[model samples]
Target: MNKDKVICPCRKLTKGDILKAVEQGASSYKEVKKATKAGSACGKCKKQIKKVTKKALKK
Candidate 1:
């Protein structure tokens, strides 16, 4: 994923932000949401957030 790509436009968060959150121990969707507030807005980004989170987990 592109680190510069914005995943959650609602919170202006990028994939890198979510990845950092994952590295910080956010393994679940809810945890990533709580940590980065990625999908807390319109909810459209939840799926992408999960994908990014899973990708980060693989690393």
Candidate 2:
């Protein structure tokens, strides 16, 4: 798995998808979900998404 690539794994969301969500103003985990529909299913991607979201916003 790519460290910087945020994959939902469950939903298979790509790093670009998460990055775009962050760029679109998804600062929080829940907000990211709304923006990308990533962690909405299964919830397995919650931790990964959260971590990447944090890093993406800082960038």
Give the top-scoring candidate (TM-score). 1
Q: Which 10-residue window in model 1 sums to the lowest lDDT?
A: 50-59
Estimate every model's Cα lDDT from 0 to 1: 0.91, 0.81
Off by over 4 Å in 1: none
Could you tell me which residue pairs clash in candidate 1?
none
- For model 2, how does the per-residue alpha-carbon lDDT over 1-59 read when each residue is reduced to its tens digit? 35456488777788788888888888888898988789888888788788888988877
Top of the candidates by lDDT? 1
Clashes of 2: 0
Question: RMSD per prediction, one decimal?
Answer: 0.8, 2.6
Tens-digit lDDT string for candidate 1 (1-59)? 57989999999999889989998999989999998888998999999999998878887
lDDT of 1 at 48: 95
